[model samples]
Target: MTALQSRIEGHILTPTGFVLGVLTLDAQGRIADISGTPVATAAVRDSGAPIVLPGFIDLHVHGGAGHDIMEGGDAALHVATLHARHGTTSLLATTMTAPQSDLDAAFAAMGPLCKQRAPNAARVLGVHLEGPYISEARLGAQPPFARPASFDEIHRLHAMAPIRLITLAPEVGGNHALIAQLVAEGFKVQLGHTTGSYEQGVAAMRCGATGFTHLFNAMSALHHREPGMVGAALAHAEFAEVIPDLLHVHPGAIHTALRAIPKLYCVTDSTSAAGMPDGDYKLGRHTVTKCMGGVRLADGTLAGSVLSMDQALRNLVDTLGLDLADASRRVSTYAADHMGLQDRGRLAAGAWGDVVVLNRDLALQAVLVEGHAVRLN
Candidate 1:
């Protein structure tokens, strides 16, 4: 294979939450070396004002940049490219609660895209099956018609595609056994969209549910008397996902949750309306309306979000008043570790040279996937 060459100069944010001097990528898309001295190459670019960090990875995103993953086909691949331009180097094409036929079609469409090797496309890490099996009560933005997944159905789908991660309600029927089966099958299980009590949530965790979906939203709220699902997630504290938009979660809550959990990763939880103007869009069978800094349904129920990972990092710093290193951990290291992605999510020798260069303003200036500059001015 012909090698590609490039050098990014700035404060390099390694996945371990440290900022180093300069990073150079060999022609073969691996970190060649890092030194204070610049490499003698024409591909050298001054990333002085921006923070060079591992490209953000989204494990749970239904749609963004005006395309829904459920829409499938090239539209799915097209939207993936859009997110790549915005600094998402890796992502899971998430699916919402929908009819069996629709879900099957989506899986069929994404299977090929996931296998195909593309330079500009954001790496489709794996499929994140949000639901077809969840509680109807806490379904959140998912369609009511597609609620709940049976054991047989789950097994069938798993057989069809290589499912990497899945989210479900622990209190739902057959969920406990399904969780155990999924763990045995080597899939990451996350609890979400339910009204499960603290005890129930704890039970799920014991059964191998290691993460939470979107932290504080789409599930039972925390209460002093009840200590619901949120309390259970906080109490366990080893693994969870937070949207960090300052809209999906408040700054105080995020800080508190981070303090409570051992590892809290940040995700966009962005919908199809993301990276687009305020308007109506489809998130599965539901119609999402975005306006004046928030997205909601006709019934005023909060839908997903319109935030990007780059902006999410900025929100953690500006809105939450967190240091750059802390914010970078939530966006990069924490998430990568939770999903078991060891090769990427860090800037080190021998790791995939997936990096994002941002300006001092936190705007995405350029992105390199596997050491090749996929997005640049």
Candidate 2:
């Protein structure tokens, strides 16, 4: 059989658990079957064999390889290809808090690329509009162009490219009143960059804002009496995004969040410095520098991260003490389920043949997106 119709062997990670077997891919780039026998959980770590897991699905991505998503015009293509090499098979091109004109130009350039993914690049599932509708008081790393939420403007950008997810501050610019309406219109709204009270956050959730963006950084902190946005998320949110780079959120706090939120997932929130040497790069309208493994602005505020999905996975297992199976879910399955993508994140009959083959050390050996092998250097 040709390479497209392939058979991959490893400790295959399935919905229930890992199995020692071969995963067969059909001609249509779908998983035809997984034939094998159940293996002990300990074998996953002790066997020293190749490991096959579902391809990572990053819902929040800004850029990589010295490219920022807001740069537009083939920037997303380059960023997607860079992350695909790091085992991210699918991602959302995340934008920053910028002016309407800048956003329009960016969307015009990126909208078409989302529909037609470049070869060797991760599938651009859709856009994740991260700003132009946030709280000015909490503009962490984002450009200082925070404005009130606008339904009209959202529709305009959505027309340019399919905006699958949005990160907004529900308390700003009458956004609290718009949550239910946005959710009703089929948008996956996430709250972030806010100075809202815990009660205000809970109210927004009830109004249909289902997720929190990068929990516990720019938003209000948890207090015993007031229980700010972080408290609200811990107590109420079913799903939320977290940057597991250890700098964004402490490992202790991440442990608490994992217990509180059932579907707590990892996001890169990466900047243009990802996969590049330490130097200055563009993040929206600001110039950020990558130094000592983190990217920061001139004022020493973290602009974004240089983290990749593969490194994030290692951090979860090696630093955070999560088992391989759980870490896989955080890096892949949970995000897919959050986005309602059943066929992309899991290994099941008829699902897309997106796989990540790793060595015993959990490093990327190879990556296949839709049954096509992606080259990794």
Candidate 3:
């Protein structure tokens, strides 16, 4: 039997701006229509005139809600549910620097689950292989398992499942060629966790590496004389992901990047500690302690974040003074554009009915993935 269509009225946010109207969704979960005039026949599902924005698309989230992606299966599902409550409708299931076998197991478990989008849970777009192929000098919280990129290993991982993004150091031997190959294979090559020089980063960009992972965190710094990866990323106007918890990058630096790189977008880079009380959490093989608004390794080096997407949105607006529309682009549209997902990151007639509803206070009121409202409480 066909389910009833839903009509929701709100101040709908688009790429350009907001439109006050009624949005109708068909049972198949794609948007049917959006009209300023209310349809009298359709049943109203939401009518409070909440601020409805396109569901956030996180490209670099590691884990959340006490479940790391390395645990796979139920952990992935749990993380998805947890982030959905905080208004993330879709996210890449990100992995950490770990053994090849361990990373393979994580991807193996998530591949089937990605095929099956759990109801009301944040949809798993694909796998983001963050490490085991990154730089050694700027490893940060990544374990010693990091290595130079290899085509055979890359091919093996891609054969395991669809790898959406891979982070590698451009200066690594044979990596420039690897970046070109990955980009040709429909993968988004992101430079990160590297001690590569500015000229090396620029060379990688020319070779089709389109993004930088967690800009300025794992990559090289911007020296006045020689701006390393940071300078190259800013100079080329490539898409760069940033952890906006106000801890990873300073607000002043974020403002500078925003002015310099128009494609700069926000990511949580959140760990299993996210949505959990301050305590010990696992980021891959290493145990991280969450405390005092930050997660850190035993040596006090910064780990992944405890930030939620909703909180990142608030930080961009309340802390950084970005307008609502610009902040929306950072959290949603930019990531979608980078991932080549045209059907998402905007509320259009043919797009999936994914939305995050917030009250005037910018608190998350509800989240809808494929027109199904997720349970917030």
Candidate 4:
């Protein structure tokens, strides 16, 4: 008989959206068998309450705890670890708009970190470049000096490293051709930080913009007659990323969006101030303050958020009254599916053994990455 490596006996969540009892993880860090009947094994572990769900994936996160990914070096990896402990098993270290040299340096630095196979490092799924192509009118927290997207600039950045996803303003100069070129290069383009009209946004979507970054935060607001970028986002159900801290977007808007968008994912949009005391921090070149439960600028513009995916999941179920099955999809399954990630978001035979065990109160009890238990409460 083959030796058991680790077995988690609890309510298992599969990517196709179902919870069931299953014996997970065989000896080689892969799921071996999943059956309705529980099996006896030497490597069994009990999750105890709530449910054992797939590990959350955050395709859009700048930083967490007290570290920003733009800070680079081991600090970025350290921040990734902080979020991993909070239930994110896979994430893309996002960057803000910066000068060309700084942006290039950040991307170059991330290459080795992305390639490293370290236990503590959350699986880095490549970089999410959130600017240098966004509109100045809806720049929000992005630096104003960075050059906007040009076809040549986009190609240069793409050649620097494997940029999996990028966020830009549809109406920005040169964005139309840049978007088409990026799509041809196999990059996932997302629209964000824009004051584009509904028609411009629709044009972007048609040109291969497959997603929205932090919906309702940095884009034009929805108007009845004009129906700005927000309207375009809500009108199309295929692509949306909502920061469900109940801060970046209000609870009411989130509910409305959940109904409107066929495919929606949750992101923290968290800043360096996360997991720390209410205080000041830096997001690229701009200074941000964390107060109450939200982060903002001196002028009271919402900077990012201080939320984690575990808390976001709880808020979805408790505040929004979504079931575990649906809420799990927002943070795990939907986000994974959105990013075209095939193996890490589900619990099934041959899928990566990334699991999160949460208790009744929605607190993370433990987390398993690649069949190895990493975080325990």
Candidate 5:
């Protein structure tokens, strides 16, 4: 028999549920087999049988590890590495509202890396184009670059790379058609940074805007009479991305969203200041200051976040009283399903070997992507 490639013995969080078992992987980055019986061979990574969960997949992330995706190239790798260390096995390299030239440069530089993931980096599934076509009223930490949708510009960028998601305001002129076109092109058009009314939001959804970006933070709030974008998102969106940093959004609001939206997932929406000491940083063209666990603009507008996926999970489980299984789904399964990623969310046969090992206390112990162990430090 061929020598076993690698075997991990632990309490694993499989799709079915948690189970104590030995999970083996093949030479290729796929689960070769899983056995309930334990072997005497040296366990490659023994953590007193820690809880092993499917690696977290973040649908929205900006930058981390002292770098921003807008800087492109190695910056993408840096962001991915930082997130990977925090249990994110895969993520979308999210961008901010910026000039067309800057956006194009970012797309050009990071596109290839998306197609071919860098070593020791979290797999970049695609790009989340978060701005330049959103609401100026709701441009939280975004620069003054917000504008109406430009079909030609979008098409050009899409041609340059696989833009899996784009956030736009439904009220922008020609946006409904753009939403329809984006949907037709297989992009996930999301409503965000918008001041659109609930009716307009619903129309955009009908035209194929399937989700909301950073729900409740940058969009219109829910009102009893008007029902606004937030209300529309809760009432009609298939999935809504939320920042669970406990700062950008209140825990009570998160609970409301989880209760109302059928699928509510967490996103870091992090900036370069993440995983670094408190200091000044850049979020695209805007300068952001990092202090006391939050990143914000000069005017005190909350920028992205320093929150990681692991902390998000902890917030859901500890702060919101979410069960481990439910929190896992929110951080991993739901986001993967939303992106149509069939191979990385669950630890089952035929799935990519992306797993995160955690102590019973939920601290990250180890991470593996494509069956290869990553250097955490």
Candidate 6:
């Protein structure tokens, strides 16, 4: 981490929008200034200069580099480094449903990593506790240890690694009230892994649940009358996360979501197979195989994915027909807004100097986490 100030020239995507300019990073790793020069929008589309965008923020991440977060021992560091190479400046270390003892052990090893930035790695912002409070009926790729919400357990784990978000079933055992409590205490709560009806989902939102996890995957489907979790999210949600690997969610469904939710963001939901060739790898307790550019279980369940944030961005634009600006919002800005992190997402004065410099083809040329450059190759 350098204390010296730095600058980069390119087509910078600032908070107000895109402009041809120079972006300055302060010695302390916050955005110092951006000096803009007027240029035609069409000119930027074909510019040889780097296209600088806010670094990606992934709220749902399990692992990468052939290592699971549950494996402990520098695994999270390796995963963070691998993702940093792909432009993720910040991420949540997502956990799967597992026994309490195992969860405790994993947190015990990773909690400190959350508090500081490590070398050549994305900032381990916090934890996304994705399980242990879900529904057994909708375990998806999660292990089958689903249980009801418990305040004591939640507090204990939060004390370990500050949980930024949680995924659970509000219709299950006293969890609707728990959602209220978690929100009141400043935690972001999301509804998922459920057989909940539309009304239950609405009720959860009323109780302060702010988002949905991996929309339309493990959650219930929308029907003409029943209007399950998907229906609720599409009808009422302003914010939601969806994996855009083109395998977890179809391009057509993604287009529908784009028109429905205002702050629909993209996440990798990536696993240990992310940067590796096709082979078997650990995704929590389950062993998943990477084949045909996707990860799956022996039972043919779609496990996590081998997608990186850079590839996710490409899919949003090249395949899904979104413009670069809207695609940048989906991959970066909206997630930061959902997390209430003003300092991490945009290229503005006083925001963290987290950036990804891409070329005309939207390939990563450089990545920065708080002004520190990470290796791309």
Best candidate, lDDT-wise?
2
Worst 10-residue lDDT window for candidate 3 reads 37-46
Clashing pairs in 3: none
lDDT for 181 (candidate 5) = 79
Q: Whole-model lDDT for model 5 versus the true structure?
A: 0.85
What are the RMSD figures for all models against the true structure? 4.0, 1.4, 4.0, 4.2, 4.1, 1.2
Model 3: what TM-score?
Answer: 0.94
lDDT at 152, model 3 = 76
Clash totals for all candidate models: 6, 0, 0, 0, 0, 0
lDDT of each: 0.80, 0.91, 0.85, 0.79, 0.85, 0.90
- List, residue by residue over 278-353, the lDDT tens digit for candidate 2: 8999999999999999999999999889999999999999999999999999999999998989998898889999
Once superposed on the true structure, which residue ranges of model 4 sit more than 4 Å away at CA?
1-5, 16-20, 37-50
Residue range 1-377, candidate 6, lDDT tens digits: 33433998999998767889899988888899999986654566687988999999999999999988888778888889999999999999989899998788778778889989997899999989998899889899998889998889989999988899999998888888888888999999999988888999999999999899999999889899899999999999999999999999988899988899999999999999999999999988899999999999999999989889999999988999888888899999999999999898788899999999999999899888999888777
Task: Tell how far residue 98 is off in model 6, in angstroms.
Answer: 0.1
**Ten contiguous residues with the weakest lDDT in model 6:** 38-47
lDDT of 1 at 316: 84
Task: Estimate the TM-score of every prediction.
Answer: 0.92, 0.98, 0.94, 0.92, 0.94, 0.98
**53 Cα displacement, candidate 4 (Å):** 0.7
- Which residue pairs of candidate 6 clash? none
> What tens-digit string does per-residue lDDT give for candidate 5 at 287-330?
89999899988888899999999999888887898877788889
1-112: candidate 1 lDDT, tens digit per residue: 1235478777776644444367888767889776553332112223344468888888888888788988877666766777788788888888889888888888878877
Q: Where does candidate 5 stray beyond 4 Å?
A: 1-5, 37-48
